[model samples]
Target: MVNNRSLVIIALLAVLAWLASTSLYVVNETQRAIKLRFGEVVETDIAPGLHAKWPLINTVHTFDARVQTLENGQSRFLTAGRNALIVDSFLKWRVVDPNRFYQATRGSTDRAEALISPRVEQSLRNAFGSRDVNTIISEDRDDMLADSMASLDTAMRDEIGVEILDIRLKRVELPEQVTQAVYQRMSTERHAEARQYRAQGQEQSERIRAHADRQREIALANARKEADRLRGEGDGEAANIYANAYKQEPEFARFYRSMQAYRKSFEGNNDILVIGPKSDFFRYLEHPAGGASK
Candidate 1:
């Protein structure tokens, strides 16, 4: 009878332990939970820490409150200029209202993503549609993303129970055909610009060279003019000296000139001359006493 009583106590203790295990639940700081009784939500916002409910009657469903990422795969969009771009983007989100989240998406992250993704895609489409390719590719991209994020956050929170923390574009690319066309156009423009620069440089160079040549010609002409003036002045001075010599001593001047002519005519020992003996060239030679007639 004592042994039976001990077994009954042991079984009761075991049952109590099982009930305790099923009755208590824990919510971590990174998680938010909902309590449901008979498939009906009883509590939506169960704070962190231990909570109690009737064993086998109440159940808690917990979701990660931490940030989660959703990657929207590559999709094509058209810019304001009708240029096509392949864009890859991602989202950062978290559940803010567990009750509404469960109601809207049945507490499924996949369903939440499904509902949020279309809105994000639509926002991207609108942004890309209103902006040009250059604006989308340049620093204005940040502003575009911010605008999209703000709009998406507002709409998502209202329609779904998730708040978007961030939206990021991973990659943006032009289609292969567009890329080739753009490259060719850019190359052509660069070549035209280079040709224009070369032409301007050539024109400037020609102007400089022409100016230099003109200056050189002017310098040479001025130098020649100065040289001719100096030569004429020297000739005039020599003529004046000769005139003074002739006025002071006419006979001596004649004799000196005759001697100079003779010296020049017989400058070399092999010099030959054909002249009449009584010609004027021999007058001074024949008259040694300075008695030649003028």
Candidate 2:
């Protein structure tokens, strides 16, 4: 009977040891815990190590409070200008207010993700709806994201009570239909620009040709006028020289004119002349002894 009593005591000590070991749990440097008694949360501990609770009456729930990175899948959304774009995004988040997170999501990280994802999508849609396609795709995209992050911060804080470390866009793309349409429009615009440039060049060429033609016409007209003026001046000068010579000495002028005519008429190797002695052609050679003055 004493041996049976000793065995019962040893079994009780063993049970007690097991209970004590299960009741107390040590949290790691990166972990946090919450205590629950009969489906009610009794306490939450953030600092690591050596925590105590009632044996078999209390339960401990541990959570990873470290920062986590989540990469979102690509999604299609419309810009404010009604242009469609494919956007890929990512976020960094942590479990802030683990108590609220546990109550809201029931201590499941997947549940927390399910709750956060829709809000992120909603925020993305709202931000995307407030900007044009050019702004979203261009260098100004950083500014657009900045604005979106601010908006996300406000929304997440007010609604989820969770701190979003950062939200970033990985890529933005045009849908196939939108891409084809944009390419066609760009091609048409380039063709129009080329047409405009060709038209301008043609106009400039025509203007240069017209200007050259006008200059040529002006030069030809001036040359003709100068030629006619010089011809008239030359004729007038010749007529004046003749008149002056005749006025100076009438007889000498007649003799000189006859000599010039003879020179021109007799210049060729072959020549003929016919004249009477009594004619004026031989008057200068007549002597007074051979003919009477009367």
lDDT of each: 0.90, 0.78
Q: Write the per-residue lDDT of candidate 1 for residues 35-60, one digit (tens) a residue.
A: 99998999997999998999878988
Model 1, stretches more than 4 Å misplaced? 1-6, 230-271, 275-294
Clashes in model 2: which pairs? none
Tell me how far the alpha carbon of residue 47 in candidate 2 is from the true structure, in angstroms, after superposition.
Answer: 1.0
Highest lDDT model number: 1
Candidate 2 stretches with Cα past 4 Å from truth are 1-13, 154-161, 194-294
Which pairs of residues collide in candidate 1?
A: none
| TM-scores for the candidates | 0.80, 0.62
